[model samples]
Target: MNPSEMSFYQPDHDAFRVSVREFVQREISPFYLEWEEQHLVDRTAFAAAGAAGVLGTRVEEAYGGGGTDDYRFRFIVAEELASAGAASYSAGLAVQEDIVIPYVMELGSEEQKRRWLPGLTSGNQLGAIAMTEPGAGSDLQGTRTTAVRDGDEWLISGQKTFITNGIQSDTIVVLARTNPDAGSRGFSLFVVEAGDSGFSRGRKLDKIGLVAQDTAELFFEKVRVGRDRLLGEEGNGLRYLMERLPLERLSIAVAALCSAEAAYGWARDYVFERQAFSQDVGDFQTVRFTLAEIETELEVTRAYVEAATLKLNRGSLTAVDAAKAKWWASELQQRVINRSLQLFGGYGYMLEYPIARAYRDARIQTIYGGTTEIMKEIIGRDIAARAKRR
Candidate 1:
């Protein structure tokens, strides 16, 4: 809502936002609370997004996708969904559209693309990425899942935890160790279908926030992944994960900011209407100043996020830039949401209010999509490497 023209958004972006807003209002807003109770957004919700042409902005049109690779449309979807207090479903959609779809587009072979792209774009079949294991969260090198090559298939056996869309996903892109002692080079990416033998989903995790998102543990017991199922070259999985991480980090940053801003709006409206002592809470000088500070912070973060978004569109976004945005925005969101919830007083603690839900949902932004500590390490290491080169 800041008036600055960041160049990342234009007339087309505005139109797309309107369309997505209408869709969210009609399809998601009415039933999000029920979905949260179930601990999973109904699969029909994604089908609605697909029907509206909002789920496949980056996919090719030949495969039932939006045909344009513009990321702003995708950004609009994330922004609108979060603004509607549909953060849980938004996180799930982010995994599908931003994380999994992009990997397949970049790393999948022609056959892989043809087999997966249509259902993915259409939302008839969901997609999920399996990365974090019980032993490996931020450290990709610690991956212990092994894939041994057999006659025509690679027998994979390991467990992946905290898998997004775990239960509903039809194809899961898994990273497994192909060579036991190759360090980071030992890893390989495999597209494992849900129907494969020994591929089973564990219990859906009972998360503190984002409850409507299907987060679960996945088990692969000698799962058969054919040679053609390999994504790009073997021993190059870590490199692929590294390359695609910037966008995923950026997605988290965007969600954090928009979610925070929405919470602020809810708090502002409540404080103005609710009576405290003798007058509206907004009449207090301290309350007014707090609103001013949060508004300013949101504007400043928006400028940086817009700059990064444009850079991504240009194919010039760097990992360090993304790390900076991810850590700062997520940390800022926590601050802003905590303050906003305080403004609501007793109402904020009640689960019936949007601010309360936003308070809970905002907690996980810093932990997932790479933790704040991990992001700081990435930025710090990049700076040290640059200094050495200079």
Candidate 2:
């Protein structure tokens, strides 16, 4: 690959990716099936990731991080983790770097940053975003969780489910309605520490895929959140979410595309090894042509995604654009997984195969971070609104 085609990654980035890849291969991949069986990744895995500096690449150096603020660094981590077939690990890391750290960096007080950011960077502290309630999924405006203005504290009462890293999180950035009548304008974000009274996690959720990643229900019953805990200004949570979601969506795209790549690579290898009609399956025109088509499609998708990543780092990426990348890449991922699985025939149907696991994991990409239908709605709305203005 040419230098620009490699994006801004230097020799150091390649080296870092190599280290991460090695870690995943050695530490993560070997134990993934067991972790999935147990329904949660080992707590030590977080500590290990923190010790490796994988958890803190995006955090500033002062906070015990790598001091590399390059978004591409985080992208490399995602790509490597996905390639290793560690979707749960990838998702957990994304929560730390993509969703949680930004709140501390952008809105935290000096003391708050010092208190939390360091532990976060070290993976000693896990973080989760508590925006979706039992009543609200994609619609943040429907949030009913209330945070009442108490003297020096806000009493937060709400329930959030399907929370990634819920069981492991030492802290959560919770979205609660601070102004009852103001609608989306009234919402606010708060950082609730794990030991706080009334901050408790319910049952660990059983999911189809990503089993090693902890998903749980959280309850905030009269949770007393101090003024020091508020993330940004009152009535600004929606704006913050909208602003940061592009990065989150991009992270999802990275995972989806990388997973597709892994699945394709595995299927190609399998075809070459399996014999059919006295020849390797890959030697058959049908199998060889299928792999060729997938490679071309994957490269094209990767290029668009890389361009989107560059735009994001430059701060010029838009929501609709991110939506396009997220949906298209995720959909392409589903296609790749399906075709790869088909190439494996009955073998693909078994969970023992990597393609089987990838097939299960790829289903959620279009559903989370906004659905494909929702993405189209957003892009279409922007188009229609611009036409009307013209």
Candidate 3:
């Protein structure tokens, strides 16, 4: 089924997509290459996105946001961004809307919400979540960033790597170890502002893909914040992370599916227009078969992702299910993009083409969010536990 025909999306969602498409054409397409060369998207793009009413669809209207609880609007944003060949910008926006904002809305106090949500929703400020430390990639328990209580303030000291929006974020949600003796119960979340003393961003990392999205190392050396900056309860941070991970993973899955569809469209158009052997490249039997296989894979994956998205909207999506969607869709994205690029022949290898950029960008989808290996481990553990009960 076409994505618009999916039962979960209403006419309003389709209407929202029209504006998002225009926003991408006007704001992103013109300067995306420049941003890629700079290794960062201009900060103004975020504000423009906010102005277009695409940045804060889930935020409450009271806080200058779209105020809809429905997740379909966010999905539309991802779809349009992917379709526009703006995957790096899409990933960065996903981090802001899907990851950081949800944490604040779900866990932040009323005061906290009032203080931060407006700027976030308005695009005056950008947000990032610091979870992956230099020594910790998939293992949240391995986070080495430490937060110690010092009188009325907490002193945070540690380094985080691979942080999205690290260089430009105005607010950051940092994961720190608060009570080392408490094991899994020890970690906590703290809200650190950009200008806070001793909070500095390291050089933007040179990545293989998604280069326009600023990924950098974040350092917190004796950064002090009052008790008010502590998010939720001190020891519940790990639990908070676990509870919110399903949304994050699902967001990645949505982006993956949309990107794969975009790449396939690009290839399908290219093959039909390019001539080889006195006929269109698509006229060849082998090319036709590849396109057929890709279409089948995408439709099948779409059905699964659509189901998961509905479950998420209903607040019933499990960690295992989201893990399954994330791994499958993301890995499928890499496969589809690679295959599509091959259809472009020599032109695909040239950086001037969107497919070439997509070829590079699609590589990271499988690695981040969580590795496919980690997703399988989560699924396997769940199965083992269920069998034990049975």
Winning candidate number (lDDT): 3
**TM-score, model 3 to reference:** 0.98
Kindly list the per-residue Cα lDDT of model 2 for residues 157-255, writing each as its tens digit.
Answer: 989988989998998999989998887789999999999999899999888888788989999999997899998798998999999889888888988
lDDT of 3 at 113: 93
List per-candidate RMSD values in Å: 1.4, 1.7, 1.0
Clashing pairs in 3: none
Candidate with best TM-score: 3
Model 2's number of clashes is 0
Against the true structure, what is each candidate's TM-score?
0.97, 0.96, 0.98
User: Per-residue lDDT of 1-390 in model 1, one digit per residue for the tens?
Assistant: 642244667888888877998999999999999998888899999888899988978898877888886777877887788778998899988998999889888888889998998888888889999999999999888988999999978999999999989989998999999999888899999999989999999999998888889999999999987898999999999999999999999999989988888888888888999988999999899999999999999989988997898899899999999999999999999999999999999989998888888889889889988999999999999889989998
Q: Per-residue CA lDDT of candidate 3, range 163-245, in tens?
A: 99999999999999999999999999999999999999999999988989999999999999999999999999999999999
lDDT of 1: 0.90
RMSD (Cα, Å) of candidate 3? 1.0
Candidate with more favorable, higher lDDT: 2 or 3 = 3
Off by over 4 Å in 2: 1-8
**Cα error of candidate 1 at position 280, Å:** 2.2
Best-to-worst order by lDDT is 3, 1, 2
Global lDDT scores for all candidate models: 0.90, 0.87, 0.92
